[model samples]
Structure formats: structure tokens, C-alpha cells
Target: MIRLPDSSGRLRAYTPVGKGGHGAGAQGPAPRSRTVFAAAHVVADPLADTTPEGPAAVDWDATLAFRRHLWAHGLGVAEAMDTAQRGMGLDWEGAAELIRRSAAEARAVGGRIACGAGTDHLPATGQPAAGHTLAAITAAYGEQLHTVEETGAQAILMASRALAATARGPEDYEQVYGALLAQAERPVILHWLGPMFDPALAGYWGSQDLDTATDTFLRVVAAHPGRVDGVKVSLLDAGREVALRRRLPEGVRCYTGDDFHYPELIEGDAQGHSDALLGVFDPLAPLAAQAVRQLDAGGAGGFRATLDPTVPLARHLFQEPTRYYKTGVVLLAWLAGHQEHFTMVGGLQSARSLPHLARAYELADGIGLFPDPELAQARMKQLLAVHGVH
Candidate 1:
């Protein structure tokens, strides 16, 4: 429960509902001995648009602080990846600079870091000029890949909206990936993002049909066994991801990006489990890191106990009109005191509804996502006041 003075300075109590009062064994996340990766997003400055190059604003201090928080929890940071609003509002130039900045920060702190390499600069909506071809796309990937490598960061080969727009079939996916993999300095994680996150990737990996796309995607991984380190599956389809994980090359990893169903996906079945690479983790770092440590103790039941409760809040934050999910994410950051204000790049904080955000606050408070739930509730009420919803 929370007690705070209202606009009129009258104190009132607000009770926060939790998951029936259970912890440490009610089906939370299990600890993983394997290295866990989180494709973290950059927290934006609330007061101004910092992206002089484009619409996105990058809150340098808060963003780096969040990364430090993840590192403190022992999770590897995958910077400049999709979770950082890449292609949404964060432009390619901004992404490259972010990778460079974060790489330096990671090095300064002895943290693990990886950066995304994609063809977002190739234009997601406009027609390619007359002579454009996959070669151009390949070159684009090469440029970004080299930049990441030069920064001394591992590479996450993200899916291309441009490729999805122009591919003829699975063959296209194979050809593009094969070329990129052949030249990589080290084994890289290939990313397969579903359209749910960004509709522009509707038929990513060549075919619109998921099964065919998976087949084509895995074939690339299979063909380049040594060069591809692992695959980041963001299809939000746990079953398919599991099936695909079973088929990966011996040394490769299956990094899950399914925020909708991560606890179960990472928990794995008899076959195997996925390593983490989620945007949700950016906000749930401490809790996720703690749960994974429990799993490492042969206590999955306990791990899930810690994570399951947060699912409702995660689901709510990532609610449909899905891409706009960033809004709720930033809101929680502000309320949790990770950032000083509630603003977002491209003004994305205004994306969700009052009731929607209201429920997010309620659910978050319920799960104890905040260290000081009272402060969170007070901030939430202030947010409600801005929209005249209180």
C-alpha cells in the first residue's frame, strides 16, 4: 500500500495488490549457467529531443546507468539492438554512435557487449534506386558489422526490413546470410524478428509462412556451423523456437526475444532452453538476473516463482499496437526512478491509454517491480493527473 499527499496536499492511502503473497517457489525464472544476453534500449531524455540527426532522443546518462545496472546483475549487454528503438525512432547514424558510446562504456566497466548490424538505412518504405540489389544490402550489412567489430563489440545480425520487402523466397535469406557470415571476423548471432514487433518484417527470412521462414533461417545457421554463434528468435512463438533450438549447430545458442512468453521459453523443456535477449529485461534486469541465478541452483520452480508474477505487467507494457510498447517501458523507468522524467524520443510516452498505463502501474506495484512501491504509485498518480484521468 502507498500513502501520498494529493494535489491539494491531502494524504491518502493506496493499497497495492501483489500475486496473492507468494515468493521464491511459485514458478519464477530459473538460474542459467549460460551467459545471458539482454538487448537493452536507451533511456531517452524527458525534457528535450536529443537527436539532432533525427527524431529519436538518447538520454546518455540514464541509458548508460541502465546498462551498468544490467552488468551489475551479471547480464551481458547487447547494445544498439532492436530494444533500443532501432528503426522506430533511433536512426542508423544514431545507432552506430550508440554502439560506439556503449562499447566504450562496456569496456570501461569490463562488461560484455554486442551490437546489431542491419540494413535499416537502406530505406524501409521507399523504392530502391534502379540498380539496387542484394549486393547493396550485403554491403550495408558489412559496413555495420565492421563498425561493431571495430568498436570491439560482438555482432548481432538483425533482420532487415528492406530485405523482407524485396526477397523472392527463402533462397534470398540464405544468400544474404551466407554472404555476411562468410566474411564475419567471428561467429555472430543472427536475429529473426517477427512482424508483430514491426510489421515491415512480415515475410522476413524469405517466406511469410513461419514454418518455411524457419526452415530457411535454420538452413543458413546449419550451413555456416562455425561462423554463426547462435540465433536470436523473436517470433514470439515458443514452440517453433524450441524446435529450431534443437536444430542449431553444436556451439550455437538460441537467444529468446519472446517477452510475451519468456519465463517458459527460457525455462526450456527436456530438449533445451533459450538464453535471454529481451527488451523486457532492460526494465526487469535485477529481477531477471536474480531469477536466473535461482535456476542455476537447480531450482526452476523457485525461478518461475520470481518471474511469473511480472508477466502480467510485462504483457501489459507490451500490449498491442505492439510497436508503441516503448511508451509504457519509459513510463515504468520514470516511475521506478531509473530516469528523472517521463519523456521519450519521438514523444512515444503518449502512446498508451490512461487506463492502460494505470493498469501497468497497478500490476507493477502488485509484483513489487519497484524498490519503493509508494514512490511509484505517487508518480503514477501524477501521470494520471496530467491527462486529467484522476
Candidate 2:
């Protein structure tokens, strides 16, 4: 039994439903119709001095083991992505190493893997001439793209903070992407991360009006049909994402990064559905695998029945200040025993409040995510006590 805090500031006693309580139905083969990848997180070296402005020091063993865990459950790994804290705390040097190591690990186990390639290496404050900025951003991307291809992994052209800061209009985006896409060793996934995730990207696609932006985005894809594989939309607006999905040129997939409404998007409508490259999938792996298995077995009803119950938990973890949702992710990972401590790169564990985390814990427990409820309860109590909770 565990006592947890609710919204009204009272502790509620809860019992363990335990893992396997959901039954997960029998795990079938991976989903055939959809390509699912879980944008993974890194385990911080708890002993490192991970200050707000300092460099990140990660636990290589734990980090790689988590990827193996995802692959073991039949999900591809989306490495060094936002879920891995790319712009937040992880530097380009760290991300490059992670890509090489994770890509190598995936090869050893026959796991599908894609790594984020972006222009995060550029200093955020440096203001250069427009041409200089575009050239530098392109060079930065080229460097990371080279690293990813050299490591034998697919590349995801992540939305660039530098480009977002520098670009004057859609033509600049097209010029930069067109050049990079032409040089790709294979078709790569493009990313359109919304301003909600990174405010620096407020006017993506050269317009605040998403429809206009979508048009410009499509124009880029139109110019390079064979060079693009798909686009990962993390806008959190389902209607817009669906709209974009319907418009993508044939053969280009829309990988849903909408954490709040993934089941419906992936299950999709009659015309087509989005594939997935989601951050929520990191914490929801076992359940997601089971749900995808159900879909693979042609039991859409079973798939919905399995996944719908977990939405409240997902919604809570992904609540406002959505970027900080990474805190809840690492917290759940700790309570569920994925890592020994809740510490994060750059001390991001402190990003969320105690109450926010308490709610996340309660919600996860409600869904039977913790393999051992007793252990989860104990960890929760330990965390609360640290914050002076009686």
C-alpha cells in the first residue's frame, strides 16, 4: 500500500495492481502497417556536476541499456532527440557520441534506429549575416549528418533552433533543406517541432499561420520527393497534424509526435494513419508494444481497449510547460526502476514541482505501469520525504 498526494493536498492510500495486471494480452509480432519509434531519454551520471549551464555527463551503460529495452519490446530507437534533451542540456559533442554508440548498439542487436541531426552546435547568441548564418547552419547539419551516416543509422533532420533564429522567409528554408536533402545518403525524416516545444521556433515555415506554413513545408517536400522519407510533426494540434498527414506526398509518412493523442492518430482513419516517433512512447514502452501487437494481429478494438486507459497518464505527463515533461519522464523511469536515481542532465530533475510529480506517479500507478507497486510506492514516499512531505 502507498499514500499519495492528490490535487486537494490530501494523501490517499493506494494498493498495488502490479505489472502484468493489465495482462498486456499475448505479445504478438511488431506492427506491420506502422513504423513506430520511441524517442529515447538519457540517464544522467548522478555523481556528475550537472549545473544549469554546464556540460552534460551521461551514464553510457544505463543509457544504452534503455535502448536495448525498447528494442527488446520491438520498438525502433529515435536517438539523441528532444526526448534525449538535445537543445535543453545535451551539447552537440555529447549527442554525436550518443549517436555513434547507440547506432552501434542497434546494429549489434538488429534494432532499427534513427538519430537526430541538427544545427544546435551554433552559439545561440551569435548574430551573423543572413548568408553566413545559413551557411553555418548548413555546415553544422552536414557535420552531424556525416556522423549519423558514418555510424550506419538513419538521420532525422531535426528542426533547427539556429535556422529558426536566422531565416528571413520560406525561401531560405527551402534553399538550406534542398541543399542538405540532395546530399543525403538515404531518405531522411524531416521534423517540424512547434513553438510550444521551443519558442525560438514560433514562425516556422515562414508564417505564424500554420496553413501558410504547411504550404511552404509541402513546397520543400515537393521539390525533393525521393530524398524525403517522412515528417515528424510535434505541434500537439491533432487536427493540423491530420491535415498535414493527408497532404504529404505519396510515400512520405507523417510520424506523429503528438503525445496527447497518439492512439487515434496511429490507429488512423480509413484513408491512412500516422506512424510514430513519440517521447511518451519512452515511458509507455511495454504497454505501447502490447497495443501495437494487438493492432498487428488485426484487432483494432483490442488495441484501443489496451491503450485508451493510459491516456490520462499521458496527458498529465505532457501537461502545459510541455518541454519540461522530460522531468516527469525521468521521474517515472526512476520509480519504475529504469534508472537508480531521478537525477537528469543539467539538474533538470528539479524542473517540475513535487505536486506535479506526485500527480504523475498517481496517474502512472492508476494505469498499472509500475512493475512492482510496492517498490514504486516506496520510491514515491522517499521522493516526497525529501521535499518535506509528511
Candidate 3:
């Protein structure tokens, strides 16, 4: 039995259910119903001498191995996404290397992969200065786009903080995205990450009003017909996502990035369903893959039965301050034995409170996510003991 701390600072006795042996569900064919990509987390080099402001020290082997694990479970890997700590700790150089390595690995394993292309390389400060012109922002985006396309991997045009700062209005956004789309060699996924995930992006699409922003966003997509494969909506608003998806042009997909209501969104309503490219799938990959397989087998009920129970866990991890959600993701990876340590790039292991992590462990264990319950329990105990929980 382990003692876990709750939000009230009270300790509760808990016994793990030990429901193991669901680890290797990735052997099945890809899901035919929806194209799902798990935005994976990067493993940290725990032994490296690093500081928060310093460059990210990634454990590339472990990171790539985790991608392989995701691919083995029949899920496409969304590389260098926010879940990988882009803009948070991972700089553009690290991200570029990650994209190259992950893309090559995807080729070797015959796994589906898409990489984020953004202007994160530009310095965040003095973004509105003379040096940070729209042309400069466009060039930065073009550079990253070229990196992704050169790897023969699909490009995901990630929402740019630089553009958000530099653009004066909707017209600037249209100009930048229009140029990038026109130059794209293949259809790219466009990501609309809301301000909640990154406060720096409050007025994305050139308006704080979502309806206006949606209009601008759709116009961008409408201007480029076949250049866009899909749009990833991370506004965490299910109704808005449904509405926006319905407005998308023919042959374009709407990939749900809403962790709060993914099951229903992916299961979708009568009109149509959203495909997925979620950060939550990083820790929930196995059960997620299983649920998608159920959906593929025309077992919507079974799919819900498998995935619905996981929503609470997903909501907990992606709770307020959703950007820190990556901390909980890596913690679960450590507990599940996907990575050997609970460390993250930029020493983000301390991002979540001990109680937050304890609850994450409990919820994940309740759903039988750990392949070795005993190992998970032991790790949880060690973590608790380190914090004087004994």
C-alpha cells in the first residue's frame, strides 16, 4: 500500500489494482476511421549539467525510442510539437535535429510522422522592432518549413509567437501564411494554438475575439485550397471546433487538439468527425490506440467504453496552465517505464507539484496504464518518499 497526498494535504492509503499486460497494442494495423498523431514528449538527460536558460539536453536515444513505441502502437508521431516542449525549453536547433532524427526513424519503421514548422528561432524579445519585419518572420518560417519538407515528412505549420507579435492585423497573417502555403511542396497541417497554451499568443489570428479570429483563420485556409491537409484546433472549445471544422473547405481535415473533449470530438456527431493530433495521447498512447482500433472495427460503444474513462485523467493533466501539462506527461512516462527518469528538458520535472504528480499517478494506475504496476508503484513510492511522504 502507498500513501498519497491529496489537494487538502491529507494522506490516503491506496493499493494499486495491478492490472498489467496491455502494453504492446501497437501491433495492429493503423486505424481506418481517423488519423491520430500523439504529440510525444522528449526525455531529458538527467545526468547532464544544465540550467533553465541553457540549451535543452535531450536524451535522443530515449526520445527516439519513445517515438518508436508510439509508432509500434499504430499511431502516427507528431514530432517537435509543443508536447515536445518547443518554445518552452526546446530551441529551434534542438527541434530541427529532433525532426530530422524522428523523420528518419519513421522512414526506417514505416511509421507515419508529421513535424511542426515554426519561427521559434527568432528571439522573443524586440519582436516588434525594426529588425523583426514580416519578411524576417516569413523567412524564419520558410527555413523551418524547408527543414521539415526536406526530410520527406509532412509539415505542420505551427502557430507562431513571432508572427503574433510582428503582424499588425489579419492581412499580415494572410500574407505570411499565403506565401508559405504557396511554396509548400505538399499539404501541411495548420495549427491554431490558443493563448491558454502560450500567453504570448493572446491575440492570435490578429484578434482577441475568437469569432473574428476564426473568420481570418478560415480565410487563410480558403485562400489555399490543396496546400492544407488539415487544421489542428487547440482552443479547448469543442463547439467552436465543430463549428469551425464544418466551415473547412472540401478535402481538408480538422484535427482536434482539444484534450478536454477528444473522445466525443473524434467520435464526432452525425455530420462529421474530427481526426486527432493530441498532446494527451503522449501518456495515453496504448489505451488510445486500443480505443481507435475499436472505432475502426465499427464498435463506437466499445470505443467510448475504452476511451471515456481516460478523459478524467486527460483533463487532470491538461488542467489550467495547460502548457505545464507536459510535466505530468513526462512523469507518467517515467512511471510507465517508457523512460528511466522523471526528468524533462529544461529541468521541467519540478513544474508540477508533488500532489499533482501523486494524483496523476493514481489516475493513471486506476486506468491500468502502467505495463508493470509493481514498477510504477515502486517509482511512485520513491517519489513520495523523496518528498517526506513516508
Candidate 4:
């Protein structure tokens, strides 16, 4: 290979004509014609790292930069959610700061953005001595909701682990959510995160049995249809999400967070399709936006063609022990050149093994996710070297 110096004096490897980024160079229009929101994540700051048992040290510059990238692609940014590592490494204080910053940034560029509002600041079992169980959770959620609303961004009422630990049955869910929704400044998006994302939320609606949970969740929405603008279901259960969406009252959008099975869910069956607000989308934003734009063009074949190749890659990243999926997410971002490094809060880059990462890279490359294959390959080499592999 011949190395040529460019204007920047950086060595550029000369390869066979038409063998570089020249092919599938830029993101093309998405094939499927539809509107699917991509929940975006922060680009970790290279300078900051997460303490094992503490809040994350976010790189504000890189963090917001990634959101800007999402807006540039005509996708809405869903911040302060699990995608951003909320409740994982992002504490309420950090989350509030993030919501404010991202919301302001979104305003500057006129970007469509929504953020998560949950009772994460409070303890699971109950609030402090002064804070009542219901009131504490309510107040914590209200604080985040107010923060999000103050920023002029929409609100996503993310499920609460605090509530999960306290609630006795379906009625508790109804009372908590019903009252909260009734007093909302505007209609808010409701979120039902399954155990997959946070196991503590298992049987979230009321019972360990899924059927009971579904009934309870739908009933709450039905009782207060107007206050609920939409529901984000992250169970990774395609059939259940679809079934629940089908029963949703008119005007209530079902934003699917089923990362493992989103392509088909977004595709929709005979009944109707789901709009998206998935975490997998944080890293896959550009590609996802391009795909959705294709669907918007009424290209069912094109949508599948573009996204189908990506499923295996997504599945590999979100494989069992799914909570650590963030590692894969950050890894791909580094490979794709979105982030400066492959490190994450809690040093989660080591969460997955080298073999797991090797497979992820292979799948992502085969699907043409990297705009610059050479960059990706170089980054892969760097990651391997760090692992003490020559």
C-alpha cells in the first residue's frame, strides 16, 4: 500500500480505485416511508470517566455533539432515558443537567426533542422520612417533568423502579399515573420499561404474569386517554407491543423500544404500525433516520432491505445479559467515529469479551455501518491492542 500525504499532512493509504468510502459513501434516503424516533445517547467525554458506585462524569461537548448529529439527520433526540445510561451511571443531578443542556441545544437548532421524566432520584422502597411513598415518587417525577417542560421539550413519563418496589397491584399503578397525568401541563408520553432494560420493573403493570400487566397498563391509558400522548414500550416483546398498541385509544402513539425486534414492529402488521423511540437507535441514529426516511418514501422493500442487514448486528450487541448492551453501543460509536474513544461510565467497555466485540464489528462492517471502513478497521485494531492483543 502507498501512503500519500494530504493537505493536513496525514498519511492517506492509497487503495484500489472504488475500494474505499466511495461506495455507500454518504447516508442515502431511507427506504421505508414512516416516522420513527431514534432515542439518542451521549457521546462520552474522553477526559471523564465514571466512578464504580457514583454518577458519571459526562463530556458535555461530545455528549451534546452527538445529539446535534441526530437532529441533522431529521431524527428527534430522546435524552435522559436509559440510552443515556440514566439510573445506571447518570444520577438525577447529572440527568437534570443533561436535560437542560440538550433541551437548550435543541432549541438553538430548532431540533425536535423529548426527555425522560422519572422518579429515579428517590429510593426504591420509599422516600426520605418526610416524603410519602406516593408523594415522594410523585414529587421526584414532577421535578424531572418540570425540568423537561421548562426546557420546552416534550416529556416522556419513564417507568419508576421506586413505584415498582412499593406498589401492591394494578390499582397502585393507576392511582400514581392517573393523578400525575391529570395535572400535567401538557400531554406526556408514558413509558413502560420491561425487566429486560431494568429487571426491577418486571410485571410492571401489576402482576408477574405478562397478561395481567398488559391489562393493567392499557386500562390506565384508557382511563385518561387525552393526558397520555403516547406510550414507549421497551419489553423487546414484538407481539405484546403490537397487541397493546392495537388496543390503545386513538391519538395515543405507541413508541416501540423493543431493540431486539424493532424492524418488524416499526413495519407494522394489518392493524397498524408502531412509531419508534428505541435505545438501540442512539448509536444507529444516522442509519435509522436514513431507513425511516426510506420508509417515508413508501419503500417497504427498501426499508427492510436497509434495516434487515442490521438486525443481526443489533441482536449481537443486545444479546443476553442485555443490561450491559451499552458496552456494544459505545463500541460501535467509536468504530463508526461518532465518539473519540470506546470507553464508558463504570468502565463498561470491559463488560463484553473480546470475542463478543469481534463478532459485533464483523456484523456492523458487513452491513456497511461504517462510512469509513479504514477508520473502523484502525479503531478495531486500537481496541484489540488495548485488550493486550497484538
Candidate 5:
């Protein structure tokens, strides 16, 4: 039995369902029915200056090792993405090193890898002229894009907070993306991170209306079919994602970054299904890969059965203030023994309170995510005791 704090701050004891088994190790080949990438989180150097405003001090070994664990489960690695705390705490220099090291490591093991390219290096202050800002954003994207290609990894064009903060209208977005697409060494995945994830992006694509934003996005993709690969929709709204996916040009894929409604979206309908590049996949990799494998083997029923139970955990971890979801991701990593501690870049371990974390523990355990229940319980007790909960 485990004791947990409910949403109202009351402690409740419940027996954890113990059916969840160990990781489905690299027992088979990768899934073929759908392309999947787990947007991995970085491990912080707990001993470093990991304060809220301090520079990120990463545990490189642990960070890279987590990538290997994802690959071993036959899931591709989406590195240097939001899951890695790209804009939150991980600065451009750190992200560049992460990209280079992860790409080299992927090559060594023949693992699939893709790295984010974004204009996150810009100075945060009063902007220059719109044209100049656009030029600067373009240059920033170009620099990151070249770096990713040089490392021999696919590039995922991350949505730029700089661009969102600078652009005046849809024409600006068209100009920026159009220029970047034309110069790409290969097709790249465009990221559309909704405002919920980053409030700064509330009016992205030059319009607050999602329909207008979708039009602008499609226009950009339609303009450069061969140079564009797909768009990762992180809007969390499954219906909207489906609508957008159906509207995508021929041969362009939709990599679902939606955490709340992934199973249904990935399961898809007769129209089409979403491929995945999800942050939630970091903690749910083993189960996610197993479910995808079931789908590949023509057991859609089995796939649904395997993944359905995990939605509650995913939704809870990705609750409002979704950007802070990395805390829960790292929390699960510690409980499952993927890492040595519950530390995070930017000292984000405190983003969610002890009660919220206790709930995450309960949900993860309910799904049998922890290989050793006793160890998870002990960790929970330790954390609770730290919070003055005896």
C-alpha cells in the first residue's frame, strides 16, 4: 500500500496495482506502422550551481545515457527540444553541445535522432525594427540549422519565441519560414507550440485565431513541399490536431506533440493517424514502444489496451502550466531508477509542490511504471518526510 496526498491536500492510502512489468527491453525491431520520437529531458548536475537563475549545469553522462535507454526501447530520440528545457533553462551553448554529443552517440549505436533548431540566442530586450528582427530571427535559425546538420542529425525547426515576439503579421512569418525552408540541407520538421505551453506565443502565426494560424502554417508548407517534412502540433487539442493533419499537403506527416489525447490521436481514424514526437514519451517510453509494436503487429486492440491506462498519468503530469511538466518527467526518471536524483535544470524540481508530486507518484505506480514498488515507496516517503508529512 502507498500513502498519497489527494488534490485537496488530504493523505489517502491505496494499494498500488502491481501488474506493470519491467521495461520491454530491445527484444524486437523498431515499430514500422508509425514513426515515433521521445522528446527526452536532460538530467541536471545536482552538485553544480543549479539555482533558479543560475546557468544550467548538466550531468552529461546521465543525460546521454537516458537517450540510450530510449533507443534501447526502439524509440527515436528528439533531443534539445522543450523536454530538454531548451527555452526554460538550457541556453543555446548547452543545447548545441547536447545536440553534438547526442548526434554522435546516436551514430555510434545506429539510433534515430533529431535535434531542435530555434532562435533562442537573441538578447531579451527592446527589439529593433521588424525587418531587422526578422533578419535576426532568420540568421539565428540558420545558425542552429547548420549546427544540427553538421552533427548528422535531422533538424526540427523549433517555434521561436523571438519570432513570436517580433513579427508584425502573417507576411513576416511567411518570409521568415520561406527563407529558412529554401536553404535547408534536407527537409525539416516545423514546430507549432501553442500558447498554453508558452504564453509568449499566444498570437503565433500572426493571428490569435487558430484557423487563421493554420492557414498561414499550411501556406508556408504548401509553398515548399519537398523541403518541408512535417509539423509537430503541440496544441494538446486532439480535434484541432486532427483537423490540421487532414489539411496537410500530400506526403507531409503530422507528429503529434499533444500529451492529453495521444493514444486516441495516434490510434487515429480512417482519415489518418498522428506520428509522435512527445515529451510524455520520455517517462512512458517502454509502454509507448510496446504499444506501438503491438500496432505494428496488426494488434490495434492490444495497442489500445496497452496505452489507454497511461493517459491519466500523462494528463496529470501535463496539467496547466504545461511548460513545467519536465519536473514530473524527471521525477518519474528518479523513481524508476533511470537517474540518481530528482534534480532538474533551473532548479525546476520545486515547480510542482509535494502534494502534486505525490499524486504523480501514485498515478505512475498505479500503472506499474516503477520496476520496484518498494523503492518507489521509499522515495515517496523520503520526499514526504522532507515536506514535514510523517
Candidate 6:
């Protein structure tokens, strides 16, 4: 039995369900029903002399190995996304390296891969000089876009904090995105990451009102047809996403980023279902792949049965202050033995409190996410003891 601390500072005894729950070794052909991509996380080099404000020190071997694990489970790897700490600890240079390396690895393993491209090279804050200008933002995005395209991977146009900070109104957004869309070498996935994921993006698409903002968003897409493969909606509003999915132009897919309601969203009604590009999938890849395979076999009920139980863990990992969700993600990765240390780019491992992490461990353990529950339990104990929980 392991003792886990609750929010109330009380310890609760829990026994791990151990191995043979939901095996992580399950692998198969990619799901034909939905195009799913797990936004993967980067492993930090724990021994590096790194600081919270410094450029990320990535563990290239372990990081690439984790991507291979995701690919082995028949999941597309969404590399260098927010889940990889872009705009947080990872700078533009690091992200470029990651995109190139992971894309090459994906080709070697015959795995599907898409990479995020944004103006993260520019300082997020609006500068008095070139950084604040729409042209500068566009140029920054172009540079990153070129990098991803050269790697022969699909480019995901990630929501930009720089654009959010600099755009004067919807027209500015339209102009900037319009320019980028026109120059694309291939159809790209547009990401609408809600402010909940990053507070700097509160008034994205030129309006604080979601209705108005979504209007601007659609106009941009409507202006550039066929250039967009899909829009990855991370608004966390299932109803809004459904509405948006219905409104998208023919051939434009809606990849759901809603961690909370994915089971139902993916298992849609008569209208249609959203494809997935979710951060939660990083840790849930094995079971998620199995569930999608079930969907492919026309067993929606089985898909729900397999995936519904995982919602609690997803909700917990992506709780309020949602951007810090990466912490719990890397934690689970460590517990599952994907990495030797529970460290993250930018030292984000300490973002969540001890109680919060404890709960995440309990929830994930309950779902049998770990390949070896004993290793997980031992890790959890070591973490707790470090915090003086014993």
C-alpha cells in the first residue's frame, strides 16, 4: 500500500492495481476512422546546468525514444507542439532542432508526423521596434513554417502569442493569416488554442467574445480554402467545437483538442465526429490507440467503454491553469518509465503542487497507465518522500 496526500493534507492508503490491467504493448495499424495525433512532450536532460529562464536542454535520445513509443502504438506524433513546451522553456532554435530530428525519426519508423510552426522566435511581448509589427510576426512565422516544411512534415500553424499581442483588430489577423496561408507549400492544420491554455492569448482572433472571435477565425479559413487541412480546436467547449465543426468548409477537418469531452466528440452523433490532436494523448497513447481501433471496427460502444474510464485522469491533468498541464504529462511519462527522471523543459516539473501531482498519480495508476505498476509506485513514494510526505 502507498500513502498519498490529499488536498486537505491527509494521507490516504492506496494499492496499485499492478500489471495486466490495460497493457501498453498493444499495437496495430493506424485507425482509418479518425486521424489522431498525440501532441508529444520533450524529455529534459536532468544533469544539464539549466534554469527556468534558460533555453531548454532536451534529452534527445529519450525524447526521440518516447516518440517511437507513441508511433509503435499506431498514433501520429504531433511534434514540437505546446506539449513540447514551445514558448515556455523551449525557444525557437530548440523547437527547430526537435522538428528536424523527430521528423527524420518518424520517416525512419514509417509514422505520421506533423509539426507546429509559430512566431515563437520573436519575443512574446510586443516590442517597440520590429517585434510588435504585423510584418515582423508574419516573417517570424514564415521562418518557422519553412523549417517544418523542409523536413517533409505537415505544418500545424499554432496560435501565436505575438500576433495576439500585436494585432489591432480582426482585419490585422485576417491579413497576417491570409499572407501565411497563401505562401504555404502544402495544406496546414490551423490551431485555435484557447486562452485557458495560455493567458497571453485571451483575446485571440481580435475579440474577447468567443462568438465574434470565432467569426473572425472562420472568415480567415473561408478566405483560404484547400490550404487548410484542418483546424485543431482547443477551446475546451464541446458545444462550440461541434458548432464550429459543422460550419467548417467541406474538406476542412476539425481536430478536437478538448481533453474533457473527447470520448463523445470522437464518438459523434449523425452529424460528424472531430478528429483528435490532443496533449492528453501523450500519456494515453496505448489505450487511446486501442479505443480508436475499436471505433474503426464499428464498435463505438467498445470505444466508449475503453476510453470513458480515462476521462477522470485527463480532466485532472488538464485542470485550471491548464498550460501547466505539461507537468502532470511528464510526471506520468516518468512513472510509466518512458524517462529516467521526472524533469521537464524550463524546470516545469515543479509547476503543480505535491497534492496535485499525488492525485494525478493516483488517477493514472487507477487506470493502469504504467507498464509496471511497481516502478510507478516506487517513483511516487520517492517523490512523496522528497516532499517529506512520509
What number of backbone clashes does candidate 4 have, counting pairs of residues 3 or more apart or in separate chains? 12
Worst 10 residues of 3 by lDDT: 21-30
How would the candidate models be sorted by lDDT, starting from the highest? 3, 6, 5, 2, 1, 4
Error of 4 at 9 (Å): 39
TM-score of 5: 0.97
Q: Which pairs of residues collide in candidate 5?
A: none
Clashing pairs in 6: none
**Distance from true location, Cα of 304 in model 4, Å:** 0.8
Clashes of each: 12, 0, 1, 12, 0, 0
Q: What's each prediction's TM-score? A: 0.90, 0.95, 0.98, 0.89, 0.97, 0.98
**Count: clashes, candidate 1:** 12
- Model 5 Cα lDDT, one tens digit per residue, 1-390: 767778798988877666546443334556899999999999999989557777789999999999999998889999999999998889999999999999999999999999999988877765434324688889999999999999999999999888888898999999999999998999999999998888878888999999999999999999997988889999999999999999999999999999999999999999999999999999999899999999999999999998999999999999988988999999999988888888888888989978889888888988888877777778878888787777
Q: Once model 4 is optimally superposed onto the true structure by TM-score, how far is the C-alpha of residue 360 displaced, in angstroms?
A: 1.0
Which portions of model 1 show Cα errors greater than 4 Å?
Answer: 1-14, 17-32, 49-53, 124-131
The candidate with the higher TM-score, 2 or 3, is: 3
Candidate 3 lDDT, 160-186, residue by residue in tens = 988888788999999999999998999
Model 4 Cα shift for residue 252 (angstroms): 0.9
lDDT of 2 by residue, 135-240 (tens): 8889889989999989999999999878877888899899899999998999999999998888878898888888889999999998998998999999998998
Worst 10 residues of 6 by lDDT: 123-132
Ranking by TM-score: 3, 6, 5, 2, 1, 4
The per-model lDDT (C-alpha) reads 0.79, 0.87, 0.92, 0.78, 0.89, 0.92
Please tell me which model should have the higher lDDT, number 4 or number 6: 6
Off by over 4 Å in 2: 8-10, 19-29, 126-132
Which 10-residue span in candidate 1 carries the lowest summed lDDT? 20-29
Instruction: For each candidate in turn, give its C-alpha RMSD to the true structure in angstroms.
Output: 4.7, 1.9, 1.1, 6.2, 1.6, 1.4
Flag clash pairs in model 3. Answer: 26-73
